[model samples]
Target chain A: MSITKRIIPCLDVDNGRVVKGVKFVDIKDAGDPVEVAKRYNDQGADEITFLDITASSSNRKTILNVVEDVASQVFIPLTVGGGISSVKDIRALLNSGADKITINTAAIKNPDLISEASNAVGNQCIVVAIDAKRKANSPNGISWEIYTHGGRNSTGIDALEWAQNMELRGAGELLVTSMDKDGTKQGFDLELMKAINDKVNIPTIASGGVGTLEDLYDGIEKGKADAVLAASIFHFGTYSIKEAKEYLSKKGINVRNTYD
Target chain B: MNIIAIIDYGMSNLSSVEKATKYVAPNDSVVVTSSPREIDNADKVIFPGQGAAKNCMESIYDKNLDKIIKKNSKEKPFLGICMGMQVLMSYSEENSGTNCLDIFEGKVKKFKTRKDTKIKIPHMGWNKVSKKNDHPIWYKIKDESYFYFVHSYFIDPIDKSTVIGETKYGDIFSSVIARDNIVAIQGHPEKSSDTGLQFLKNFIGI
Candidate 1:
C-alpha cells in the first residue's frame, strides 16, 4: 500500500472556542471550533485534530458539543485530544464520531491508561500524545519530560523512553510535541522526533516548530515521522494546506495532494 | 452527468479520494459503492486503495468484483490510483500468498536501493513523472511534471508500450500505466496539485 503523507490541521480549543497563542502566552480567541474545523475540512485537510486545551478544567461539556458539531459536518477523519483521560472519556468521544482519541497528561500520570484505553476501544483508536521539552541535563540529555495542564507542568520522565513504553503498551500512534518549539515557527525539532520515532513502532506525528513547508519536509524526511502537525502556520494563513502539500510533493515528499 | 463510481473495499484514504473527486467533478455524479452491479452501470470507475495487496485483492474477490472489473474495464473508462494501480499488475512481491488482478503484464517488486543513500525504504515524496505515451490523462501536464508518490513497490511492465510515465527513486520506475480503457497512476492525482487535477479532468473527459 502507498503511504500517503498526512496534512493535519490542529485546532487548540479553550473554553469551547478555537484559540492560539505564541509561546503559549497572550492567547487570542481564534473562532468557533466547529466553524474553523469546517473551513479546514473544506480546504482539503487530510485530517482534523481537535485539542481541547481546556477540557481538563471548565467547558468539558462544551468540548463534547464542539466535537459533535465538527464531526457531523466534516466528512474526513477527526481525532480528538486534550483532557482525554479515562476510558469513559474516550468512549464518549468515539461515540460522538471521533475516529481516534489522543491522551497525553493522563497517559503520563498513569501509564496503564494506554493499555486500558486500547483494550476498551481498540489499539488503532488510541493515540498517546507526548509533550516534551529539551532539558540541559540527561543523556541525549535532551529530557523527554511530559508536560501537563496545557503544557505548564513537566513530569521528569524521559520522553523517548516513555514513548517506547507507550507503544509497547498498545498506542497505535504517538503525537510528539516539542514544548520548546510550540508556536515558535522556527521548525520542528527533528532530533527530538527522530529519537522518539526510533524507539516506537507506531506512527509518530511531529508537532511544534512548523514555520515553513521545509520544516514539514524535515520533520517527515529527516525525523522519520509519519505526520507533521501545525497550528499557527495553518491558522494564521501563513500557508494553506494546499500550498504545503504542493511544496512537499515538489520536493519529492509523499503528501496527499489537495488538487487530486 | 459524468457519474464516477469509487470502488469501496473498506480501505484507508477513500474519503479523501471521494472529496477530491467531488472537487474536480463538481456537478457530476460521484459515489462510493462496493456493489458490482452499480460499478458495472457507472459512467466511469475509480479504484482507490491503501493497505496490503493481498487484502485489497481479497476484498475484491469477496465482493466478486474481479469479473465486474474485467467487464467494465473493456467497456468504460477505469482509473486506479496508488495501490489501486498496483493491483492492476500481474502480481505483487508483497506477501506471496495472494494473486493480483493481473490486468497488466507486469510484476510489482519492492524497491531496491543502495545503502549509501539517505532515502528511506518507502519512496515518499513529490517526484517528477516523465510522460512517455501521449495519453489523454497527460493533458495539461507538462513533461516531467511532479506528482505525489508514496509506496515501497512499483510495477515493472513486461510490455514497455503500456508504460505511459516513469518516476525515479533509487531507479526510474513505472509511475503511470495505460492500456485500452484502463488507466492507473502510482502517484495520487487526488493529492497532486493543478496538474494532478487536470489529469483527473482529462480522465473524466475520456
Candidate 2:
C-alpha cells in the first residue's frame, strides 16, 4: 500500500488560546484551542501542531497546560514548538503530551541542542523547524538564509547547509517554513522546499503559504514533502480537512480516507 | 474489576493511550503503572513503549517487567504498540544491536534504503495496513485500513502465522502480530484517528 500524504492543521497558540495572523502580524483570536483541536480531530486531520508564538518564561506553564488539555481531548500526534531552549524543556513538553518537540530559536543559538536532545530522546521525537527566506543577492543564485525570533532576525546561515547539519545532528524530521510565502495566500515556496527535500534524507514538512487545495498537492507532488502544515486556511474554515483530503484523492494523490 | 493496565516502564507517552482507552471504555479502570504486581492483578494489559531499543530493554530489565509481561501475555489479553512490539522480538538492530525478550521468534531490522529507493526512514505518518487473518481484535477496523506509523525498524516474525496484519514501506513487513491471547501493532492506534480508537475499543471488547 502507498504511504498516505499528511495534511496537518497548525495552531499558533498564545496564552492558552489559538491565534491567527497575516504574515505573522495583525493577530486575532480564533477560538478555544482545545475545542478547535477536537473539531480538527473529527474532521480527519492527520496531525496537529501547536506553536506557542509568545512563549515566554512566564507563560511556559500555561503552554504546557494547554498542551495537556489538547492531548487529553485529541488523539492525533501533537507537535509543540516555540521558546523551547533545552533538553529539559523538550522533556517537559513530551511528558505533557507532545509527541514531538520542534526547536528553532534555541537551536539557532546552540546548534548542539539538536544533537543533545536527540541523544537524550530518540531522534523520532525531535523536530527542528527552520524559518527561511529566499535570498536573491547571495553568492549563489539559489540560496535562502535562516531567520530566528519569529522571522525577525536574519542569519547568514545557508538554508540547505543548515538542513544537512540538522540531519547530521540526528533530527528525525524538519519543519521547513518559507517566510517569503507565509500568510500570503500565494502558495508554498516550491523552490525552497525542493532544495531542502533533495538535500535531506529525513521526513520534511512543508509549512506556510498554503491558500488552496492545489497548493497542498503541489507541496507533496512537486516539493516532495512528506507532509503539509497550514494555519489560516484551516483555522478560518476556508477549507475543511475532509475537503482537502477528498480533493487530493481526486487528484490521484494517496490520502487516508476518513470516511471509509 | 476489569482494570486495563498500561505498563509504563518509564518510556513512551502513556497518557494518550490511557485517554484513548478511557474514551472507548469509560467504565473500565485504565491505569498506567510500571508495577509488576499491578500488571498481574489487572484483567487486561496493554504494553506500550518508544525510544531506543537498548534503553527500552534496559528499562524493562531494570523494572523486572519482562517475566511479568511474558507470564501475563499467556494468561490474559495483551496488546503492544510501536517499541512495545519490538521488545517482544528476539533481537533488534537499533543502538548497535540489542537483545530482546525473545517472546516471539523474530528479529527487528532497520529500514535499509538505497539512494534510489526514494523511501524515507522512520516511516512516520499514515499507511494502510491489510489484515492477514480473522481475529476478534480486527473487529470494526476495515481491511487494509489506514493507521499512523513511526519507526525505522519493522519486526520480522519467524512464524508468519503470528502476523495478522501487514504493511509495505519499501518492503512488505509485519505491522500487526497476534497469536493466542496477545496482539501488537507497529502503528500508534492511539494517535491514529477514529478508526484507530476503534481498534482499541475492539481490543477492550475482546
Candidate 3:
C-alpha cells in the first residue's frame, strides 16, 4: 500500500574492475563490473549504484563502458557517483542510460553546481551525496559536520544546514553517509540519519556501516532512511539482496517482495 | 516495419526510453525526434515528459510539437509517462497553475506530505500498480505488479472510467489510464526491470 524501502547494492569499481568493495564468492571473474551487476540485478536489488573510484581520465572510461554494458542488460535504475564534477559529466552518464548520478565534493565546493545541474537535468536525476562525521569537541554543540574529499577534509559546515541548503538549491534526494561507521561493520548512526531525515523533505538514503540484515532494518525503522545502501555486506557475499528483503518483509516492513 | 516515435520535447532524458524500445522491438525502427512530420508518420508514439509541466508545455509550444502529438494520440497506440501523463490532462496545479494538453480531463496536483508520516516529496522509487480494468496493456502482467515511479504531483482525471491502474503513496492515486488509442502511465515502463520490458514488448505488439 505504501512505497517500499529501496535496497541498493553499492559497487566500488576502479578502472573497470570490481576491485575492493565487493567480493562475490560464487561468481567467476568477480572483478568484472558487468558480471557482478547482473548478479545483483537478477537477485531483485531495488537499484544499483556504481562509485567510479578511478583517478585518471583514461581509466574513467572503464566505468562508462561498464555502465553502458550493464544498462543494456539490467532493466532497473542505475546510479553512478564518485569524481563526477561537472554538468558535462552528469550529462555523459545520463546519456549512457544512467538513471541517476550522485555528487559529493562538487556539491560542497561549488554549491551553485547543484542548482545548475538541477536546472540542466531534472532534480529527479540529481542526487547530492553528504559525508558527515560526528564532531569530537563541539564549541557550539552540534552533532555532526559535513566532510569533503571522501571524509579526508573538514568543511566545518553543519550536516543539517548543508542538507537544507542542498534541498533549497534543488537536490531531489540526499545520500547521507556516516564516515565514522563506514567500514567498521557497526550499525548506522541512527541519530545522524534521523536528524537529517527530520531536517530535509526530500528522500534520504542511509549509507555506510551495515553489518547485517538487522542493520538494514534499523536504517529504516530507527534511522528513518527511505533507502539503505550497503557495500561490503552485499559485495562480500555475506547476505544476498533477496535474503535482506525477506528479512525486512518478515519484520513487517514493506519491500518489493517480488523476488522468489 | 512499424516505426515507433519517442517524442522528445527536450524536457526529459529520453535515452532509457529510447534504449528500451530499441531493445524490446529490435526489428522495428525507433526514433527519438521532436520533428512533427516524423511523429505523424510513426505507427506508435511514446510521449515521455519530466521536470515541470509549465516548461514541458512551453517547449512543446515553442517547437510546435503539440499539434502533432495531439493528432498522434488519437490515431496511434500512444504512451505517456510521468510528466508526459500529467500534461495530457486539462490543467495542472504545478507552478501555481499551468494549462495541459487537454487530451484527457484531469487536474495534476502536488503531493500533500503530512509531517507525522515522514512521507517525502517527489515520490521516487518503485511502487505497485493495482489493475482496475482489463486493458490489453495489462497483457501477461499480474495485478499489483511493481513499476518504477518518480514525481511530486499526482493526477485526478474527471472521467473515472479512464483510470486503469491505481497506486497508494500518501493516498491512492491514478497510476495508469486507458482510452481510445491512448495508453498512458505515471510510471516508467522502460526502467521497471523484466516486467517493464514485457510491458514495452506488449505495447509494440499492440
Best by TM-score: 3
Best by lDDT: 3
lDDT of 1 by residue, A51-107 (tens): 886745756877877876765555556789877779998878775657678988788
- Model 2 chain A: lowest-lDDT 10 consecutive positions: A21-30
The whole-model C-alpha lDDT of candidate 1 against the native structure comes to: 0.78
What is the C-alpha DockQ of each candidate? 0.06, 0.74, 0.74
Off by over 4 Å in 3: A21-26, A139-142, B115-118
Q: Clash pairs of candidate 2?
A: none
lDDT of 3 by residue, A1-260 (tens): 48899999998888888876465666788888778888898889989999989989877767778888888878889999989989999998988889899999998889999999998898999999999999998786658999988899999899999999999999999999999999988989999999999899999999999999999999999999999999889877899999999999999899987665
Worst 10-residue lDDT window, candidate 3 chain B = B112-121
Chain A TM per candidate, in order of listing: 0.91, 0.94, 0.96
Q: lDDT of each structure? A: 0.78, 0.89, 0.90
| Quality class of the docking in candidate 1, CAPRI style | incorrect
Q: Of the pair 1 and 2, which is ahead by lDDT?
A: 2
Q: What is the interface RMSD of candidate 2, in Å?
A: 1.4
List, residue by residue over B80-180, the lDDT tens digit for candidate 3: 98889999999999888999999999899888877655578899989999999998899999988999999999999999999999999888999999999
- Ranking according to TM-score, highest score first: 3, 2, 1
